[model samples]
Target chain A: MYCRQPLRTIETIDDLHYNLQLAVELEFSTLPTYLQALYSIKEGSNTIAYSVIRSVIMEEMFHLTNAANVLIATGGSPALNSPEFIPIYPTFLPDNEKWFEARLLKLSPQALMLFLAIEMPGDLVPISMITIGKFYENIEKGLKYLDEKMGADLFPCGTLDKQIEHKYYYGGGGIINKVTNLDSALFALNAIIAQGEGAPNKHWDPDKSFPLEDTTGIESGDHQLFMQPRELSHFYRFNELKKGRRYVLGDSHNSGPTGPEININYDDVYNLKPDPQSGDYIHYPELEEMNFNVNVIFSRLLDQLHLAFNGQPKTLETAVCTMFSLKEVIQILMRNPIPDNELGEYAAPTWEYLSPEERTLSSIR
Target chain B: MYRLDDFYDLSATLTDYPVTRLIGTGVGNEYNQTLSQWVRQDVLDELYHCFSQLERNNDGQVCPQALRHQLLSNEKYGPIARNIIKMWYLSIWYKMTDNWSMTYGIPAYSSPVIGVESPTPEDYIISNNAYIQGLVWPLMGSHPMGAKQPGYGTWSDAPLNSIASIHLQ
Candidate 1:
């Protein structure tokens, strides 16, 4: 592997902004990869399995929004539109020390294993670290240190009005606090880490606590829409599936799921070729057409989400509808048989976006 | 609640599965709700009559495996029963064509009952979720392709048991 930039001390406000934008990119990158896998499941057989994976996806979206909220609060525009935001899979994560190549594939043991590793927390003590939770921790430290050194006005980049608050999102899990100062910024950062890694001992207390007053008052009761044990982390959830069981109240991190056997028949899934690019299918026009449609819908989703994030709350409903439509198109692609002498293999969505001009044209139509 | 359970009983009789289990976890009841949303009222009324008649033949009680004989023997109710079975398995309201009906061993009803008016009888999906919940997957020892997913590497193992006996019927 080629060497890259070394981790630097976050001394300047500009450095903090840059790092938070990186955080946004990191959060943004995982959605399509996770969604591609989630969508590739055979319809309706693994209802429980689908739910577990989908909960992760929803939380990931909340993470993306949370990062954007923090960035906007700190007076930086989140650079989500960059092509670099889209990951080149089997590639290095943002500032990871160990070479963990994140691959985009269908929901298989391998994909779930990768997901577990990605959410794995760093060294418990907050020294030099490599995990995503640490990366955000460093950003949190920078936000406070810079706030002291550069003054409280360091985060005047955006206003509360600009933040994508709780109103825009539908899921009742996770708080979207507007980060105007260091405390709120740290709150946002801690929330990210808590959800990603879990509590200090990895015992997720379901009834722990929630921010009581939702500014918009839309969210109520349970912080999560569905009830899951509070102590389960992303890593643990994936591990439970990897081990073919469900976790119980008294189970430790290393223990197997003591509850019910999560009897998942991984067979009969669409044998989608992993990490396919638009260029890979050019030889077959039919596959190419399917790829184009997938990209068009994907691009439309991003466009609508962009609007939704940029102070137009009504666009969120439209974005959700677009997401459901994307599922339909992706399913059609997954159902189509792949050409050649391959058994059980099926055509899959490439998850590419349409060209900018085409996106514009399609949006107009 | 009563009518819905009666419908489930009718569905269970036709599909040869336990009505209690079907009500608890099966898609039959859910599919029936969706069917009512778009299915023509008159056709549903006719189906209710047919189902009541079938139940009447069994002491006005829905019995386990009660209609299996009629599903095989009777001409008037056989095609209708087959369509309900198809809807449960495939989430498709397959209209009975005269030739296709006969070929499938479903003797056509003397008074033809046209289902919900569609431009054509080309099979259509019930709902996206309904399609995923279709009975065909488990009957074939497979999961639906794009909805509910199992864990990774789980597919590498062979299915522990086959419901091929149930499928064969």
Candidate 2:
């Protein structure tokens, strides 16, 4: 057992931008896997497990936005369209690269356990170690140090429009805000930590008083939800699902959710094969076609998001529409069984990025 | 003889919807059940066997023209194909015309038919679930009333495609 050395924090603006981009990719990497589990549920059978995974994925999207905003606020472009942005399946999440691998599997005991590990709270980590929470903490320190050293021009002027504010995103339960300056940027980091791995308290939403207004309204003038009791942060939500229970108001992180029992039948899930790839379906042309279709839309979404982060913020509305359209194809993939697999599993979208030559229907055919 | 895959392939030709999109509607299996219960077993088998012949033309691609000539225009299988399309788009399965039924009908008419205007029992909305998932919703760039709503402000966007474009290589 050797002593662990402290990992280097972001020391420059370039360092900050690079690390934040990694944060964006890191946050994004979990989505396909988590959504696979969410969509795998036979409709209305595992409603409890379904919603838990759904909420977690929503928060992960919010985290991606925050990371992109921080990268943009530091005068850096969010590079997302390249193939490198999408990590190969069964790959390690940057935080867990050294020890564990994340996979694309349907909701089962294994997937839930993987989620628990991915969102494991920093408080649970040994000191002098690097977890995702520690990664963010280092970014927080880097922001402070750089803001002091660089003085007034740290975050450049006229880049404020690049940040995705509350006006851009809407709907169910992810904290949306802008990152304009040091305070707002730091607040973004705090929200990521507080909601994801738990704040130092291990069970509190940072800035508890932050107002979440009517998600549908163009701007706030109606139905502002204030001081709603904190929902389970990511780590604890998975824990509750794994424990087959709920976390009540007074429960601590380690309390293991002693509320009313929740039931999820593992048999109700679609049998998604672990870590499917585009090449895996050469024998299954229609599955390949469906899989390719998913990649086209998925790639388009990444391009649209990149555009939204860099300059064209209004594109987000269209982006949201594009995101919703993905459900149909993914559902089709999940519901159909893989034709001849020995495991009798279903096909799933591999979340691969299509090259420009492969993007067009005619071109690929 | 009663394979869902053949039924899906057959349905794709009749409905002009991708097999994937057809399944995505969450009623393909139900539509298959509707076919089994309403149509004669031999007729269903005859219709599905056409897909096996699909391997002959266009290098194994699904050709609407061939299906139209062989099944859609056939006196025996034609009406069945038409009803399959209706069941998918409108969630209602129409009984064969009196002459066709007299010639080739099964006697398993389950009650709870939604169409009461005709003197004889005519058709049914398969289920409330089926009606809500009707292909009409996606076709019209809208959703069934009080179900699967895109959300609050989806109306402003351009109409999304009813079917994702399919490419076979």
Candidate 3:
């Protein structure tokens, strides 16, 4: 019974900015889920899941950057440095047609299920809601409409230069094509949807199959089990992991994956406590102190990102470097066992934004 | 008697690092195990017991004065306490003095040091990971040698949350 949410009406310039910023926040929100799940995975275990997850993580960073570029193209800024940018767990993926809670979890059946839902295909989006594909569709329409109504004025001169070129971010999948004009803006939005939900009526993961097989229209890539250029959309990628097999040429979404066995030892991950909060660690002073540092590093990351997108584009390099450094502190939390903890779980990071007053250990103490 | 919490807090108190930064190194248990292998069991228990007594006497906080006067001043515990600081900051277990070892070394055939991984065991690096994670790198605003590392250009940005900044009131 879920119909498309009435086309999101973007009338004025401000509406465009609002919706684009919404896109930025929506894209930004996925980072922690991916990060927590990635780090929770112990080194060298779950190789199939790890590569799939790692590849998707790189793409999501692209998606986030793409969204920011689109937003910045039209005289708007990404609001990452704010506390509200981070999502609280068991929260629904932003603008989901149907409500399903997304939690920060170790790599297990439960987390794979959540990832599947978050990346659920446009046609597969259940209940009375528009697909994420549709949501971006509306944004696409909004940009086209505004451009027709207000031509060159829509993308003012000098604003296009602000778009982060593809060079800043490494890795293969995420091409950061600058979103300067209306054509480029539309192209960028399309890129987001294509990578995210796949093109309308397209087979979700076509590359894994060969041309000689009984597969439908979707045929591209090296036609191998492990795709080099990241052919599987996030949904099908998770499905491959969930079903414990690869999507061979003849397999349908309903048929589920049946190719090679993917070994995922559920016990391999460091069981970080889900949706942990900074306040929870106050009594456990050692954990509190560790989380304080977690918050400080995470907060600095947001600030660097803010600087990166706002004007200091070169700062993105610093921001990327700072992000890798989080592994040191977060692994400390993930690897440590909590005292008298619930569910026999290991410690998890809170990933909170540190207010200026709360930045230093002295204030937190 | 060999409690991880007591050892962590003791290291924090002696090393002047926050309990979090000390624990954040993720080598607390290893360090505790090192202490167990090297120090005499009886003396190790006495150090923790004295620390517990100091906490109890000072309303459950280790009073700085009592830490200096009681456990750290005692001949058996004092050198061990200083070594714990060295272990945290440098990831090296400095050999106890000959005079001190003659009186209080653990009963083991391996004379100079107890850990097996060292080439010259008088003083030894704990683990490669321990060396990489030593507090001195962050304290000096650089990563350890041989790990010369992800922090190359525009470095010094990662340690904005270092112990120095944390202690800055």
Candidate 4:
């Protein structure tokens, strides 16, 4: 139901920036909910899922950084410390009064559904529709504003006229905009859905073979399968794993009000009980330490950039390279296991690790 | 109108010494060397090339008067030039205070430099912003040039405040 709308249109730099910022914020906003959900799951039962979630969280941080860099390059400060940064679970949509609501927090079947909804392809939210989804409209307006303000120099790569492709899409569907090629599209998909959804290729539904069947029915067909049925699997697998039961693949599970088949519920053999109140959650008090360590990493990276730029010919170049290095660190942390040791126990890799090749691009520094 | 040389000299003086030099030193040895070379050559070269077209005389030195005239007359380059100036200032500020928590090994709010004894929940935001701005703005010999000052306005006005609120919530 959520993925039925068309892609939101973007025309200008501000629109891109605004949406980009919102995407970054949303990525972070999902973390608290994700952590809560992960912790609620019985420990050791959802190792792969947990790993995926952690990776997504880390990549979200990367996206946030990328957005910040873009904002800075365009002469704007990346505002993470805004009240709007973290919305209360299920905040009201920007303009719509009753049509749509943006959920901030709350662990429910609907919560996961909402996650699925937000993450559905951009094109699903029909650009023509008004009441069903307004994100497209917002994007269109933002793009217009940006185009008016910045003109054609919006993209840093200087290939403004090139057709961009969508980052992530359902196997049978068309790609999202501004994601021209497979690499960029994959990168975008990775940034948005890579962590929480498991492997990128695995996201494709194998059962429903391509040349996607069109069932326009509101409560029947693909829409039903997409919204109500699939979400239940999220809850069911979670419940089964908590009870130490073997959650067979393709078995129907109820999530919130919806019911769906369990796609890949690995570690079903592990007998893990949910912490009564928390229920099926991963308990790691060290997460705070990880957060602090990340902050330290960011600080150190900035410090290094400052040193490398010392009034030299290649200051900007070095800054860009440092940005790339920071991105690599974020990527590594996303995949790495959570350090169970004391604070600052795990040593973060340096820029050298990020840039394996020691080739100096510029002689300015 | 004054010559291009004057503008080059002025920009070089502003970008090379004082704020840039100060921030560069504060960044420590490795960072300082990298930046010094970057300033003298890369950034300077770009600025000179941009100003060359606007140069009134063949002589390289463009006086302060000439610089002002170019800024006012040129449309395409004016905003970019101003932004570059602002960026330098912001860079200085960012470099100075980016590491407050790491440097002192204390929380953001409880900084002695900002006069917070036992930082209230609110104090953290103000102190963090002050620290960050303090470092970033000086490099360009300017501050965050906006109508809303850092401390004033809604808690949302200051980024640090907003961030703190989010985390606490």
Instruction: Using lDDT, give the best candidate's number.
Output: 2
Question: What lDDT does the true structure give each of the candidates?
Answer: 0.64, 0.75, 0.73, 0.35
DockQ of 3: 0.30
Output the lDDT of residue A146, model 2.
94
Candidate 3 root-mean-square deviation in Å: 5.7
DockQ preference between candidates 1 and 3, better one:
3
What are the per-residue Cα lDDT tens digits for candidate 3 across A103-147? 778787888888876776676654356666777878888898999
DockQ score, prediction 1: 0.03
Regions more than 4 Å wrong, model 2: A1-6, A95-97, A172-174, A201-226, A362-365, B17-21, B40-76, B96-122, B132-169
lDDT per residue as tens, model 4, B83-105: 33433334321221324223322
Residues A233-351, candidate 1: write the lDDT tens digits: 66666777788776655555444456667767778466678777666666666566666777787877777776665666456666776676577557767655555725556566765
Q: Where in model 4 is the C-alpha error above 4 Å?
A: A1-16, A93-108, A122-365, B1-169
How many angstroms is residue B75 displaced in model 3 relative to the true structure, after the best TM-score fit?
A: 5.9
Q: What are the runs in model 1 whose C-alpha is more than 4 Å off?
A: A1-4, A124-129, A199-221, A224-231, A311-314, A341-343, A358-365, B1-169
Pick the winner on TM-score between candidates 1 and 4: 1
Chain B TM-score per candidate, please. Answer: 0.63, 0.78, 0.77, 0.30
lDDT of 2 by residue, A1-365 (tens): 01122447767887777778778888998998899899899877888787778777877887888889888888988888888888888977754434567899899999989998788776676765567787788888899999999976678887878788777655435556677789988878777776677554455543243222222111121222222334556787788789997766455654556667889899988888889988888888778888888899898888888898889887777777678768766887777777778989888999977777888877545
Worst 10 residues of 2 chain A by lDDT: A216-225
- Work out the TM-score per prediction: 0.65, 0.84, 0.79, 0.30
* Candidate 4 chain B minimal-lDDT segment of 10 residues: B120-129
Measured by TM-score, the strongest candidate is 2
Ten contiguous residues with the weakest lDDT in model 2 chain B: B110-119
Candidate 3 lands at a TM-score of 0.79
